[model samples]
Target: MLIGEVSQRCGVSTRMLRHYDALGLVKPTGRTSNGYREYSADDIRRLFHVECLRTLGLSLNEAKRALDEPDFAPSELVGELIGHTRARIAAEAELLRKLERVDAAAPAQWADVMGIVTLLRALESESGARRQQAVLSQNEGASLPVEALAAAALSEHDPNVAGALRWSLARAAGEGLTDLAIGLDSAVVEVRRRATVAIAAVPTAEATVLLRRALDDGDVMVRSRAALALGSRHVADAIPVLLGMVVEGRSDVEAAEVLGVLAEVAAAADVIVLAMQDKLDNTDDAPTRLRITQALAEIPGVAARGVLAELADDGDRTIAATASAIAHTLDRRKRQGFRN
Candidate 1:
């Protein structure tokens, strides 16, 4: 077959076939008297082989060596090609993510688009300061996708950066609530803690409801935070978790204070007092009993007073002493109030 016929028959362009010949990658087997390049069957087969190698991302030199050298091992070259392909795929995926984030921002101008891109890049910076600054400026550009803030907050390590990220998410509120809610279920303890903190600050009814659900999370840290937030919001659902915190000695003092607040705000002081008394009856540990006795001072009203009076007679010396002191304090406050 001549060059043109070969081009049609093999589907390799005449120009490309000539270029391959020049590079000694593929040479026609013979030339006709008319000075046209003539390809034999063997030459046609080589051209087909070169095209096949090119399809596998082989460079012309590599493809030529593969066909010309009988001992050429494809294993090493194939491994290299796989590595290159993986790198390209990763690069392409990163680009796609950037585009999606930019589109989510809905930038009004080229400058806004660039700014959002810069902020997004800085959020991933190795410097904690840069990451915090990026989050603080998260609201400056076009609205970023809530997923961006959620992703940043979940992975942030530096205390300052994590606080800033949580604050930013809370301020953004409805924008990222769903994504932050999902982070509440993260396998990483720190991420779940951050999610709870961020969601706690969100001032929405939906956010409150989300935090209430977190009260049942397996992580004590998650449940404690959610319980505290709900307690402050007068959500009586936090009662069980708060009592558990007192019993487990995790943030027991703060839990007591929040429980007091919940009791006062919701007028559930009797209920709170009853729960404390139940724990007092079941618990045999001296220190846990001490914590519970101290926690009682935080609760208000006559019901808490009666519990304190009964605790004052307990067999434990420290428990009896603390309860006596708290009972006197509450009695003194009551007298002072009546005098005023």
Candidate 2:
């Protein structure tokens, strides 16, 4: 087939095909007497494989390695690529969360009109320079151009523009953008809120300090957001505060959510283990006990395994099932590690 036929069939532009040829990615099977490129069936098949790899986000160089090395398993490479993509997504998600809070805090008038315009303007400016910086904070590693574009989009005030920016930000977060969580200004309430949500999505040591400060805010809303954000960091130091809220505070639902977040961040088995122990021993609230057990499962560490084993024998079938599942996962991980 000629270049045009291949481009039309494969959905790749002729320019891209030419570039691929230049890079020795997919050479023509032969050349016409007139010096035009001619692709054989094998060349077309190779082009398809290249296209697939590109779709998977592999750089040409990376894809070339996979193609050239017959023993190279695309599955393994794809798994690694997926991990990278997830990190980027997480970071971008964090950015979207921050933007959402910005939108929420903006005056209602802005929501109706000029607000989106302002956001778009801000995003456009950032998109030019700070995009990479923002995305780099996430684990996914954002490039300068992409980050700049995203920041520019985010700074716009037009609701449509802001919405698009938000979408891009969310995608960047899903790709594991973590940069926005760093060096946040706690003095600004909106900034704090955005930081809180972003930190919750991707908890870090620095975020713990910010969250702790927010938890101490005089405003209940600030305190709630802070407490909720602490879920991602899973800092044991915050446990006493979280426990107090759950036991004495009016917002039981919020407290429960905090517990759930803590469970995700918990490294020490006893923190959640002891919380579950307390809830089980003193609280006749079957529902609450079940909730605590579920949270306990979120902690992933060796200590959790022991606690889970103990809980598996609990009288409550629901708790027992959760504990059994956790124990099974831990055991499987251990076995896999041993084999490795």
Candidate 3:
């Protein structure tokens, strides 16, 4: 077979085949009378081998060594190729994600595209302050894409930066809701918690619905944040988790406050009082009983006062004293027409 025949049949271009011959990687072993390069059957086989190695990401020099060096172990070279291929793939994937985020921004000009890119780079900065500034600096002039903000919010480990990202999402008018919803489904517990935290700041009904889904998250913080957010929206579904947070003493103060707001309704106040009473009955821990005692004070109405009145005379001295103090305050408020 001549060089052209080999190039045509084996799919290696003529110029590339000549380069391979110059490099001594797959030299054709025959020549016609006109002195044109000719390829023997064996040379074609060697050319095929080089092409095969190239497909696996081997450089020309590496392919030459692979075919010519009897002592060249392929295991190490193959492993290196695998690593290089993976790195290339990862780089491409990251680039694709960046492009997608930029496209989502729908930049009106090259300047807007540059601005978005700059903000994205800042968000990924090693310095927490820089990352936070990236989020804080987002304004009407060069508003960031909501998807970018949502991604940053989900992955940020620093509380301050994360808070800024959440605030940015809140101002995005629910644009980040869909990304945050997908984040809620992430297998990473912190991602779910961050998603819930960010979603809580978004005041849309869609945000409220996503928070309800997070209420069942396995992470205690995720569920607690969701419950607290829902409680602020007066979603009744948060009642159980709110009570649980009080019992566990996790963000118990905020939980109690939200519960108090929920208890403004007479029917809800009645149920909350009973639930606190149940916890007080079941727990022998003085701290837990005290937390329940304090939580009950947040709720107004006769039902809470009735529970407090009963707790005021309980056996635990601290709990009884605290309950007495809170009950007295409730009475004073009622007398002042602050409660019924």
- Using lDDT as the measure, the top candidate is 3
Better of 1 and 3 by TM-score: 1
- Please give each candidate's TM-score: 0.89, 0.37, 0.81
Per-model tally of clashing residue pairs: 0, 51, 0
What are the lDDT figures for the candidates, one per model? 0.87, 0.61, 0.88
Candidate 1: tens digits of C-alpha lDDT, residues 188-208: 888889889888888889999
Tell me, by TM-score, which candidate is best. Answer: 1
Q: lDDT per residue, candidate 3, 1-340, as tens digits?
A: 8888887899888999889889999887888999989988888888878889888888999989988899999999898888988999999998898898999988889988888898888987999999888778776656467788888889899999999988888888899999989999999888888888999999999999899898888889999999999988888789999999998989999999999988887778878888888888888999999999999889888888888888888999999899999988877877988544
Q: Which ten residues in a row have the lowest lDDT in candidate 3?
A: 137-146
lDDT score, residue 131, model 1?
86
RMSD per candidate (Å) reads 2.6, 23.3, 3.7
Ranking by lDDT: 3, 1, 2
Q: Output the better candidate (1/3) by lDDT.
A: 3
Off by over 4 Å in 1: 1-15, 32-34, 139-142, 331-340
Alpha-carbon error at 99 in model 3, in Å? 1.4
